[model samples]
Target: MSSSLAPGHPQVVVCKWSAELVRSMLDITPHVFVVLDEFDTAYMNPDWELLSRAERVYRISDFDSNEEISAVAADLILRRASIDHIVSFTEFSQFGAGYLEVLLGLTKDPMRHVAFRDKRLMKDRVRLAGVPTANWITLADPSREDDVAAVRETLSFPIVVKPVAGSGAIGTVKVETPDDLLPTLRGIEPDPHLKSDQLTAEEFIPGREYHVDALWSGDTPLYLIVSAYYRPRMSVLDTEPGADADATPPDGSYVVNAEDAPALYSRVTDLHRKVNRALGITGGATHLEVFERPDGELVFSEIATRMAGAWIGAVISECLGYEIHEAIARGVVTGKIPEVRPSRPYLGGLHLRPKGPGRITAIPDEEEMLAVDGVLRAQRLRSAGDSVDHAHPSEWCAFVVLGADTREEYEALARRVCDELRIEVEPAG
Candidate 1:
């Protein structure tokens, strides 16, 4: 960690939706440059007034290649406003930012960024490093019939399929049988953010799933929290036939005590360290998901080189008594990791989705939701006229935050909140 080129401010290049996050970083040091996406201009342009408060803004579309991005970054460096760090807390911006970082001499290796972006490459590296992961094969052209045949011939039933480069569980699916395989494969629409046309067909590991969120200083994990989802993320996509994607499915997640499940904790943390090392991730926040088989074997799910989305950062802050974003900002800017750890015993967060697709007619009152015992925060992400897409968890309409002294207490509070909360929607016509 070197000091910022400027007297006190470190110039950082951030990508996509991370502009808002830079506000907290400004408190630690000034000079945040955001790279925007052109497609987002239609909705984000109006918000630019507030975002422009940063030192500078660049658009990804403006640069045709990584070389161009590096060229512009080099010009900035020559002007004595050298970028101290190039970072993106979102999957969309990681690869490009990493390339720019290497070009600007910010990162020691470039493959670290590549591993973060390409799932197939990542799995290869993890396997080579001797970390346990599901058996997987890549589909270069998913639309091709032969590729679908390859998946059927090789992988077992209930195989997990997802884009080689995707986030937020957007195009992920579980093929339970041969009949469901081709349709599920064909139904995966292209994502603009995913640069690769390849798809992954991996053996589905059945077991309890958990995610570990941690901030690292090189190979050392400075802080860690393990969370278990009430239901696996992919299950949210398994809706009833004719159901709308916006319809909310049943889902909840809560932080778990490491002491209560020491064996599980040890296995997860050990793998987390291995994955970080395999990917060459030396710093920044990481979000990794793993599975615990019924037989008690641990298997890797996936890893991201960014903070967990779905408001997990907020939940972590609420439980730990520190803002993860602030710690990450300070770490990247000054190369100093915080000493803070989780202060609370147990905390949980739940999302309530519309029962079916339609216009949202009504929602539970905020005051009523907050009144629930152990409920810390209640927010309605959708309004009366807003349409709900039930296909994915990302379309869920409302969320509740909860805290309790014990896991039993947290589960009780979450169940009560779900049972009491009401969200009415008219079936889509």
Candidate 2:
């Protein structure tokens, strides 16, 4: 590996690894240093060619921590003459990359990144900007009765409890009442991804949920995609009393066409613009989740400064004739998101989970899924012999991206696929 970069190749430090993302970054510059966590490196098993192409690759035990990121930056500063950009393609490493951006004097004002990472700070900034958010109270000490009482006074039953800086729905609990508050909060098992014991309990807003993914050029918007969920994401946390776990309905989202949903597109994009301006979002990508009340008021759920996960990018690429990561890479290099539009009327990814806890006797193969009507792409992450764990609904076994010429056809196709597909599981292996 070389310690110095060739002229005209900017020195870029990538906080994580993605074959396509790294490849795109390297296309513009040979001086790319990739920082990856050991677990991701092992699970992804990136190709040797991509790893070899990067100027340097650092595999540390932890990539999300400030200490680890700072240490790596210090080492890079000592080795290289100058660092141009520190970027993160995933949610977990966004803070680390942004933190380093400021520490290296690449940007000013740490709050810009800190506000995005810390739920409390994020809410504070968003609310101060007059964007409606769930009324929340932070627990300095979840074990302390005083903190719990504060939540009871400020919020109602069925509030949500979550880590101050956590992503996804992991480590989140919905507390129904005062009695259940302490027990639920205490029952949250610790995970390595959880950065702090501090939790925030906020009022739960019930409504249809949707996420907006956008690419921005500084303060201006480049492109935005709005997708509505088939069901509340929090529903994945619990299995219905008698529902079959292995036969659980496909839980996923679909892209909303701007013309098909002109009003929805306007509302979400307008809301996103407000939040983006408030958060100081600039030349990059973001995924914002929001809820629409029954009467049509949009409430803020939370926003992340990274790409949407769960094969969203792939589905978007399949429908839009381009990749979101490609747009992001281009934005990083040229401060612009290339113009791209949806080619299909309806597009979405349907995710399937094991209905019941058991041994998997069978699962549809990729070829079988592709044969289904309107199915454009299919990916099977599990095998016939793999054990089925319904407890974690997020761990989907397979998914298919569906494309259609009309919304009616899209709905029919989704139902047909769900009813036809089967995940045969036995009580024991």
Candidate 3:
């Protein structure tokens, strides 16, 4: 029997990857041996059922012993002479999980992902490399009330608090005073899995938030895309008003939902070069979040070794007219980047949440929602008969996405669309 499989080989391979964006990329890829490693997490979407044609499927469990995970990895490697590529969609799992692949001797090096999941640790590394980051401190002990006081003393007014290691602004809270502290901390436990060993308190930069999507093709960056986050006009104004009102969530909290804001792509080539050099991030696709303070100071928020989450892979792909996730996969497989270029300059996205409480009965004007100029896609994660509560983490049913030729144009259209679009819901019976 031949020890290796070629491009035309009929053999199949499964994958350990999950996440809607990553799964979409894998589904569209051409034939090759794939090993889908984590079945439990990946199975939430019906997309997994389509992988039945893969060469091998490895169902690994998070609850399994490290020994079991290593064993499964070794088994897959032994069955196939080698894996052509290993790709992940998130910063945490890309390094956390990919390290295991390295331990099984599947990859050239594991050090590439040392900055895996912990946002605090990633910032620490980048800071040591002279990257300008937001004024921040991580809670050494989360359960202690005194540490909350300590956070107040160490930081200025309007501190940004969140789990030290989280993604997509999940579990993130912004508090302006001592009175606003406890409820914000407690409200974040939306899931038991949301718990963290520590929390981060950082000086909330009062300015515009932005992201840079860049791919590390070996020792240099290629196709850098810098995006300016639409300042949540609602959150920025609502922060102080709600602070005086109550500590309840979704209603009285100070956090921006990405879906609510539109992101603009700019050719900030110089800033991209400076940030990449500062972080020493030399491999894979990297997503960097930043806050450009009103004084023109560019303060770093956090940087992920992978693409920005919350369907950002799709946003970048749409804006640039290239497949970034697949490009990352192919680069990992071949150690080279094919010639791909940014096709257009545009702004994209609107993450929406419900304005009032009730079970969503119907979304009456979805076609109208899509009719606005530069509105590429509009979707509501919640459907008819779905109920949403005053929630945290910004995952709500009433959402809309818009794309435009200019950031100003997109924001204007989004505000109008949000006002005009309505979710007819029946009040609690």
Candidate 4:
């Protein structure tokens, strides 16, 4: 076993408050140590299952700060004499946890983590490294006249305004025209997560969207899966001419097996390798989004140093015959590349979001959702009386994972599930 992972020493996870994470890492180590911020754990309630069973749990006030995270890690080491490893499974905590490792003499410089989370810094690094991405400019304050002029001069229309430090596409929007840019800028409220609500505008790259979920050890990916979205993810931000603004487009993606599309697999893998090199992520799960242009160019979109979300894990489990959620944590702790056992039938998933902002009156149960054909797993995220204010694509209330023999069938089945499944909401007054 690696020095970071001894047989019985506590495996430290600067937790994202995930039960699957605690259970998964426990498989590799006898004891699991979890760290959480008081802010998030209050809402999530870490008293459930595996988290409760952690050998030790540390609650900090400022999880967003690396110093605070490292302090907890340092304190844990003092009490335990030794710790197996340190890692985090969420976007918000990845930097903080990695910094902890650095402080413990396990990792190197921390600028790379900053580059991963800060949109402006991420694009700058990628661009300098000769990676293809949409041209972008950063505004410390979009409300300022100088910053607004810079955007007007530098980026063209239909650009996206994104939070410098954001996750799940929250506080991200598409500004369709130059005339609408100022109004769009004025309309956005301050985001607490971002540093001074800083923004980065990347001129939109037009293409079909895909997300690659991979486990990296050293310079290359040991295991990776590419899945293409059913439609461009940005469509969630789009407004239709005659429809209600909140009428969400059905969201889903089907995995593209390497055997079926060898060329695409090769290209994407190679591109992802370059991205990993440029960005400086050496280990654990990476969820990458990219754009494939009409002329067969792959443009880098964005990446999160965390696992893929929106039922990608369930899709992987259905096709690969294992729970990737826990397997990934297991892989990180034990330093073993996860075994890949590919199974038959093309698989995909649909994310069912609430219709609009409202107190959620009703959400379909697992049994009700499983009535749809070919569904392997149906998960309801919200219940009756649970309120939902769908501001971004990540505000989904349910997930449906399904499979079929052919790619066409997989696509058809995914749509069918979306059309049939319902999230009856009492619309916002």
TM-scores for every predicted model: 0.87, 0.91, 0.75, 0.88
lDDT of each: 0.75, 0.78, 0.56, 0.76
Per-residue C-alpha lDDT of model 2 across residues 1-429, encoded as one tens digit per residue: 346656776777877778888888888788888988887778988777878988888877775667887887787777753787666768778777887887787877877887887888888888888889999988878888888889989898889888888777767778888889878877887546666778888998899889888777766667788888877788754653112444434487888888888988887877888888788877577888899999899999899988777767777676557776677777777776556766567898888665677787888999999998788888898888788766444666888888889888887777777777767778864
- 201-304 per-residue lDDT for model 4 (tens digits): 98998988999988777666667889988668778534421123343235778888888889998999888878878887777888899999999999998888
The Cα error of candidate 4 at residue 175, in Å, is: 1.2
Summed over model 4, clashes come to: 1
Ranking by lDDT: 2, 4, 1, 3
lDDT of 3 at 378: 59
Q: State residue 251's C-alpha deviation in candidate 3, in Å.
A: 15
Write model 3 residue lDDT over 276-304, tens digit each, in one string: 56555556677777777787666767777
Best by lDDT: 2
Q: What's the TM for model 4? A: 0.88
Candidate 1 local accuracy as lDDT? 0.75
Best-fitting candidate, scored by TM-score: 2
Clashes of each: 8, 8, 16, 1
lDDT for position 110 in model 2: 74
Worst 10 residues of 3 by lDDT: 248-257
